[model samples]
Target: MSPDLRVIVYPPDAQGGRRVRVDGEILGRALGPNDLFEFLRQAAQDADDVCLDDGLLIEWRGGGPALGSPDAA
Candidate 1:
């Protein structure tokens, strides 16, 4: 099986903590405890690429879809 690219956040001094959101939403926190494999599997199915706050990027296979023409900023 191929390797999955993703990051899992472990709580500090706590169990069943929040999971960080992959999208570009700062000050946002994930709700509920989740399994790493399951979360990445689902995210990979939807979005082709995922970015983290710490300058870490996890891209899916096939490089995902290409962006459209450069329209606006």
Candidate 2:
């Protein structure tokens, strides 16, 4: 967690898909098609648990192509 961390949220795309991006990096891309609702709920919980003063919580919503290899990011 960095003091200068930033959060950005991108709304789901036409296909109701979401991603998670932190700062300028893509954390994960393309959540499960059948689990979008559960995903969002869990994401909200996870984001809420994060200490805002510590780092940042970012959520990117959309069905666009995932940025990079999710595991290495």
Q: Pick the candidate with the highest TM-score.
A: 2
What is the Å distance of residue 49 in model 1 from its true position? 13
lDDT of 2 by residue, 1-73 (tens): 3334444435554553445455565445443422322343444444334432222343333312232213211
Q: Could you tell me the TM-score of candidate 2?
A: 0.35
TM-score of each: 0.28, 0.35
Candidate 1 per-residue lDDT, tens place, 11-44, comes to 3223323434334322222333223234654555
Error of 2 at 38 (Å): 13
Model 1, TM vs. native: 0.28
**Clashes within 3 Å, all models in order:** 0, 2
Total backbone collisions, model 2:
2
